[model samples]
Target: MLERLQAALDNNDAQGFSRELGNIAKLRSMAQLAKDTGLGRESLYKALSGEGNPSFGTILKVIHALGLKLNVQLPERTV
Candidate 1:
């Protein structure tokens, strides 16, 4: 799952990543996810629906709610 998300990120496919997250969240129950993330259920649905452009904070919250973390890495090339 992480790999798939990473692939979407690497490919610059924001919608794909959001859609995948939405699918996972739905599987875990949107109500539960909303409670866990402290976000409104409808907002979560809109953000992760692959149509809405969610904020970064929202993305982080959803990722954490899904028991995932977004790791940062330096580019391999050195300046």
Candidate 2:
């Protein structure tokens, strides 16, 4: 599931990423996630539906709720 999400991201597929995210969210307990993220379950669904543009903060909350870490490794710049 996570791999699928990463693949979507690697491909720069926003809608696919959102769909994958929605799938992952469905696998977990939405009530728990809502409580953890302090977001409504319905709202989570809408945001992760690949239609709505969710805020960065909301994405962060969802990622955190899923117990995943996002690491950033920028490529070295060529002078």
Candidate 3:
């Protein structure tokens, strides 16, 4: 799931990222995820529903709460 989220982010696919987040939220209740991330449950739902624009900070918090971490990698170059 984390890998899928990272792929979405790397591809700059907002909807895909949101979907991955939604999946994660389903595994762990949104209310609990919200409490863990220090965000409002409804707000978190909106953000992960692909309908809300969440800030980078919010994304970071949510990722952390999910026990995931984001890493940077150089894009592969085609020969």
- Candidate of highest lDDT: 1
lDDT scores in order: 0.89, 0.87, 0.84
Where does model 3 exceed 4 Å of error?
76-79
Query: What does candidate 2's lDDT look like per residue over 1-79, in tens digits?
Result: 8899999988888778877888888889888889999999999988899897888798889889999877777878999
Task: Please give, for residues 34-54, the per-residue lDDT of candidate 1 as tens digits.
Answer: 999899999999999989898
Model 1 local distance difference test score: 0.89
Looking at model 3, residue 79 earns an lDDT score of 100
Worst 10 residues of 1 by lDDT: 1-10
> What are the RMSD figures for all models against the true structure?
1.9, 2.0, 2.1
**Candidate 3 structure quality by residue, lDDT tens digits, 20-78:** 98789869888888889889998888888777887878888888888877788787999
Q: How many residue pairs clash in each candidate?
A: 0, 0, 0
Model 1, position 19, has a per-residue lDDT of 80
TM-score of each: 0.86, 0.86, 0.81
Considering only N, C-alpha and C atoms within 3 Å, which residue pairs clash in candidate 2?
A: none
Candidate 1 colliding pairs, count: 0
lDDT of 3 at 73: 77
Residue 69 lDDT in candidate 1:
80
